[model samples]
Target: MDRPSYGYSAADAPPPQGPTGGPSEQPVCPRHPDRVSYVRCKRCDRPACPDCQRPTDVGVLCVDCERELARQQASTRPRTAMGGRMGRGAPVVTYTLIALNVLVFVGQTLAPQIVEQLGIFAPFRALAMPWTFLTAGFLHGGVLHLALNMYALWIMGQYLERTLGPARYAALFLVSVLGGHTAVYVIADPMGYSWLTGTVGASGGVFGLFAAAFIVGRRMGGQVAQIGVLIALNLLITFTVPNISWQGHLGGLVLGAALTAGMYALRPKASPGADRQALARRSALVHGALVVAAVLLCAVLVAVKTLLVLGG
Candidate 1:
């Protein structure tokens, strides 16, 4: 027995006790003091019950910490180069254009002279008033006209603006406006009509957006059949409706599809570790060229129409 004697160690000692010489009290949830919990918030290290806890990367966080983290993330969201909100957030460009159209309509109501000054007329009587080609897209003939155009704009503008970003969206709209007016100017007098025949509305731009949505949606693997049906229905209406500008709608649709196709063609193909900035620059240059080409084509068409009118 004397040969196997063991020495006393720390493990052999009695466990330490609290101030009252008893076992320590179990931790309880701050929110529910009666319920004992071992879980603690990763942020504040506060004891929290399962009901008050939110799982995170590191560990569970209390409800307050989770909400605060969410707020911080939302505040730091990225924006586009043009200082507009990025991604599929609110369509600021769409809303701004709508507001501008409404304001211009109100102004038109106040001063009837604005229609003559801003509306697009055939035969190019006032070539000096070239701004009318663009401005006419913002004008509305009447309340019903405005309501219909704005409704279409609201639906299509939101989709296109979200898909194409603000700068490209704005360019598409302006080009569509020009395209519509150009079409009217070129073919409006094939049978010798008056040069005073004028047109005004955002329908051209709206139709352009519709065309863009269809093209972009198809490219991105969306419901193509539905879009096609919608486009066909609209075309039917354009052709059947009395006083509707089929030329403008067709012109806008063609231009929109062409512009979007050009953009797709010019877009840099996906490759291993492609440089986004370089791709964006190249795309911008291509867009600028396309816009210039469209403008030149429009000018040529206007010049041709003017010569024809003068000759007649």
Candidate 2:
């Protein structure tokens, strides 16, 4: 003091202030009141401790804000190429098919004569009412039969419709039905089984859907054990149960698997120039080919059966 203080003294020092040039005040985390923090959340502008912070592209955000942002992003995600909306929307195809089946069942109940005309009979007689090949799929012998078949259809149709879209799904189903009837025509008479004379039910198409579900599930990396078990149980029932069409079920299963396999094989490969629309067109062509092949096979089967019966 006597020498006039060569070094700076305490009286000349600046006062301490907060980061924003205001008087210093301790800031506690909003989530944890006891924890003091100098950092603020980028989203909410509230004090956040390291434990409650989630780092983002802009800056760190609080846990609550981060959760909200994630929810928003998920809600805005786009639909898949196959028209699936990430669990949103009703399965329109499945519902329409169920309605049609129910309507047909009601009509069958009202007009009992429709069964004899529409139901598929032995191959020789079935040829006379060729349309019965498809009509039989819509006709059910009893309430329990209709209920079981419709229930199976509903369960499998939703998944397939979502995965394959409506047009492809419809084609697969119709082709599968034809395939089932074709199998019966080829096998029933040659086996000389009197009980297999008349066959009626949507079990053929239902079996086809079962096969489709298994194929799709496997493709999507899902566990297919349950589907396989269900298929096995149904097949066992088809062979062992009275009045069940084992031939139809086997034919449908084979055709469904073949059609799905064909589609998978024909799936368009990604290229720099090709767009999604182009790929969709190619897929449609594949489906068309499968349908045509199914129809031709049915015709050939009928012809062969007729020849064998005539020759014998």
- Count of residue pairs whose backbone atoms collide, per candidate: 0, 0
Model 1 bad stretches (over 4 Å) = 1-88
- Which lDDT value does model 2 have at 171? 75
Worst 10 residues of 2 by lDDT: 5-14
Model 2 Cα shift for residue 311 (angstroms): 1.9
Deviation in angstroms for 115 in model 1? 4.5
Per-candidate Cα lDDT values, in order, are: 0.75, 0.75
Tell me the TM-score of each prediction against the true structure. Answer: 0.70, 0.70
lDDT of 1: 0.75
lDDT by residue (1-312, candidate 2, tens digit) is: 232322322223233345676645677675675667777777666667889988888999778778877766644554333322333478787787788778888887787786556665556567778888887887777899999998999889888887887777777887788888888888875557642477778888888889988988888889999999999999989889987888999998998888877776666664665454455556567667867887787898889878987797
Where model 2 places Cα greater than 4 Å from the true spot, the runs are 1-88, 190-196
lDDT of 2: 0.75
Report how far off residue 116 is in candidate 2 (Å).
3.7
